[model samples]
Target: MNAMTTLTYFFPRRVLRAVVVLLSCVCLAASAAESEAAEQPNIIFILADDLGYGDLSCYGQKNFKTPNLDRMAKEGMRFTQHYAGCTVCAPSRACLLSGQHTGHVHQRANGPIEFRPDPQDISIGRLLKNAGYHTAMIGKSGLACNSQNGNHPAEKGFDHFFGYISHGAAHRYYPQVLWRDGEKVQYPDNHGKEGKHYSTDMFVADAKEYIKEHKDGPFFLHLSLQAPHADLNVPAKWRDPFVGKFKEKPHTKDSHYRNETHPKATFAGMVTNLDDAVGQILDELKEQGIDENTIVMFASDNGPMSEGGWDRNFFNSGGPLKGGKRDMYEGGVRVPMIAWQPGKIAAGETSDHVSAFWDFVPTACEAAGIKPPADTDGLSYLPTLYGKGEQPEHDYLYWEFHERGGKQAVRQGDWKAVRLDFQTDPSRPLELYNLADDLAETKNVAAEHPEIVARMREIMRKAHVDTELFKIPAN
Candidate 1:
């Protein structure tokens, strides 16, 4: 051996050996951490209640500006052909979480009142939890009303939940008590009138806390904000700006809930407040150093509401789409959706890749490297998100409503077919609209295209399996 090598061999050989082993272990630990981080990404899905397709400035809302949402669109991918599950709340949320269409989803309508997802049901939360991720739902979880009755968010795979359980309770922004996990936590300050405590404020705080707590996380967060819905009430600070801007019509008071004298201003304020929440969530992700590895999504539950003195036509909330909530039109189902990831999803992109609430399940599964349940109607849009591979197209998309004389709609390629009053009269003539030609859905060309109408009718018939609660009446 050389003179230096012989000197090193004589100088603490056991100490040198231990030092080399320690270095190897340190490198291995770092490699394991990097691998875990790469395998799992944080997911944040923010669902706005009763927000219309054109409610955001980015989506063409001219009356009020939504700067944050517009910025989000500029920083992310905006979806022009994205749709909500249904025209209502509970069913729409169910479709989103369960990854099932209205036909197959458990909650078909707003009521069989106090509807909750079955314990054994396959939900996005459960799927993610099974894949070893922390899951939480904050804000208006209209899925289950009474936690004591047992169909709580906890049962549906959320480790933590804080929000209004009942759909009706959600209508009132300030409530006496809200559900926290499995218990009802009282907010005595929030009485009948506008109190110091605001549900939206609470939700935002909770969401931020959750993110901070799970920063070193593979976490799934569903931030369901009850904004711009009905009972058009907002905090004075948010509502003050829009007051007296638009031509006024005082909203007549209702017994069920408080009414706003300046409904127009209040509505705009509520939406802007929601926009602020979105901005805050994005900021939190960035601050937590997880923005690059997190996929942030924003979407509405359904179309704008016509109730609580809110005017859909005045604001052009549906944009060029025909009809509002409850109608089987583009306005009711089609809503703005934005997906943001710094490097993963291409920035300043727009995707017309037709997708809906059900599609989210497979998309989330693909992102998390988890296998989605076999029975899901959803197909993953991860390819579109990643902007890499070929994205598979859906044969058709379908939706059915139990209320409003019963309505069903199907979209096959560029053609849309609607069967209105289906339960009342199963033989009613179908309305066919070539969405490619008429985005407004003004003209019905059933007489011009009999063959397409027939195919649409058949698809509607097969799309839905007979459910006792949402059944086609026997004539």
Candidate 2:
């Protein structure tokens, strides 16, 4: 007390006041930081494999209803003109995680052989991990690389990862093995056709558990579900309801996919099962009281596929668009996309904002209050989600496919152009369509619109950066 009294007498009143003000400011700054962290919403991105634009009830599925997904759209923002990164799985996911388009992204195709990307390429998982979010990737990851090469989801910045690492391995619903982090977790019970553990069910259960464990988190979860894709597999409970719902069509031709007595019904049931999985995750979030602090987004990696005994025409899976998975048409790339966040994103909003998978990284970064890498070919759609601020628009969108003899497509405004077999015939004439008038792409108006076609041709050429891995031959 004697020393404190002597020091206080030596110190001037203005100096003592300045010290108090500085200490108060420090406390206020710390409190603001804590508040900001609490406000950073947890992000959950649910990617469906081969689920089409019209597969969901809200999106015009007549055979089966996706009440959960429909409700998600009702409570959030539904994107009418959203597109996937590519027409296939591997490249589409590559574009998504890398924040690059198919033109610029690594792993441009689901090749005969698996391809691995450069380890230096940044991923959305790494971006969020750096932003202090607990990251996990569950279900099928078709990213073309594994932990051995330092490209598995865990090595790519996800703190945890579970499910199938290979795209081909993910085709089977009842798997004998699944990946957990860097190790393979064997499922003895899921042996052959006598397995009770469906991969979809397991993924949903694990996702719920992950949410529960990270209830207080600003976590980032990529729950990639393998459903309504192929093999015509679904639990009896889901399949039985739609057993006789449609006229029976037995699919026995495809040796690659399992023989299904009721292919249509099974396909419908698989979609409904996927819908139920989404509902379960939403319920878990609500139960954990984190619904308001979470942003849940659902989208398919690509459009519908006629593989695995699943019929695209029967489901009208591509909606009013033409073509399917392999084609560069609207049906192949255009997909269903929805975003939900209570108290933040206003309900009952449908955004016709033309967006794509590449935009996700920037959007997520903005949501987390982190600056995205400057070189990304994506724009944040956060402003559109919040229903405020001036939303930026893209000049055009481009996609190139290596399979199906190589293809390229470009969409600028309402004008869409498709160039087939571009690798072998670089001088192939671009088939142009006015999407606003011909959404089905039945009419090729390229001859009538030579100027627009010429512009699209140039854009396509400029957009494609020649790569040894996925090459587009010169004219």
lDDT of 2 by residue, 283-346 (tens): 9999999999999999999989997677799979999889889889999999999999988899
Q: What C-alpha lDDT, on a 0 to 100 scale, does residue 397 get in candidate 2?
A: 93
Q: Candidate 1, residues 161-228: lDDT per residue as tens digits? A: 99877777788888887888788788888874477788888999999999999988899999999888
Those runs of model 2 whose alpha carbons end farther than 4 Å from true positions after fitting are: 1-29, 112-119, 145-151, 192-194
Each prediction's Cα lDDT score?
A: 0.87, 0.87
- Residues forming the 10-long window of minimal summed lDDT in candidate 1: 142-151
